[model samples]
Target: MKAHPFLLHKWQHWLALGFGSGLAPKAPGTFGTLAALPLVWLLALISPLWAGVAIVAAALLGVYLCEVVSRDIGAEDHGAIVFDEIVGFAITLWAVPFNLQNVLLAFVLFRLLDILKPWPIRWFDRNLHGGLGVMMDDIVAGVLACLLLHSVWLPLQL
Candidate 1:
């Protein structure tokens, strides 16, 4: 469906679209994930506790933002609505030490889990609907990615 003319003008759409990264002609989800890196870095700079708080807040707000934009554009889980990606990426980086290697690993793993939607991730994506549906699959992906990084990858590095 064609995007609403006011999609960009609305605050919810602006955020739900990942600050316009979701508008990319192709690979909008990838672009939205990329857009989240800077936010992850900033959150890391603040402190893991604060970063956690912000990630939780963003995920909560994302439901409303995603829902409003989806309704406005007359699409469910539109590729252009990517607040889920942003929050998911943030969750993947939670408490992760801010380093290029760690960040890149998290990025690759999160992207893979998100795109692949294995098992319960796919289950959530398929069964849920509306805003919660839009946010959950990615949330699960982020959690899995974070667990992998913390449990397997980080241990191997030690």
Candidate 2:
């Protein structure tokens, strides 16, 4: 089915929009990240291993979600398709043990890497296409955040 903007009735469109969090007119990505928090917190509570699993699952699901939503909306990587952001933030917090301080720091770090799109992140965003393209840059940002988080924490542990 060749869907369009008028098809707001579809579940895929809503899912793509991060269930309307991404519909925010200003800083939609920030809202999308905020929408990811509860899920992140819940998964984090289940233990670090489960949180990692959930992130992986969400990312795999995100590939399909982006593909479907972008196709349905007649665009690729639409601003409103933020399941990638959700998954990315989840990745940022993986294995961190999820205290409020850690999660907030991850949020800030992920947003910075994501918005700045440094290095390979920018390359992936500019060069890739389709659903995987939509997800790859954010995944890189999450990885960057993870590394930064660990670097800081490890020094403190030393």
lDDT of candidate 2 over 1-158, digit per residue (tens):
43336256777677778888987877878888889988887887787777788788888888888888888767899787888898888888777767878888999999999999999899999998888999999999999899999888768877
Q: Which ten residues in a row have the lowest lDDT in candidate 2?
A: 1-10
Q: How accurate is candidate 2 locally (lDDT)?
A: 0.84
Candidate 1 positional error at 92, Å: 0.5
Model 2 residue runs over 4 Å out of place are 1-6
TM-scores of the models, in the order given: 0.93, 0.91
As a whole number from 0 to 100, the lDDT of residue 151 in candidate 2 is: 85
Question: lDDT per prediction?
Answer: 0.89, 0.84
Least lDDT summed over 10 consecutive residues: which range in candidate 1? 1-10
Question: RMSD in angstroms, all models?
Answer: 1.9, 3.2
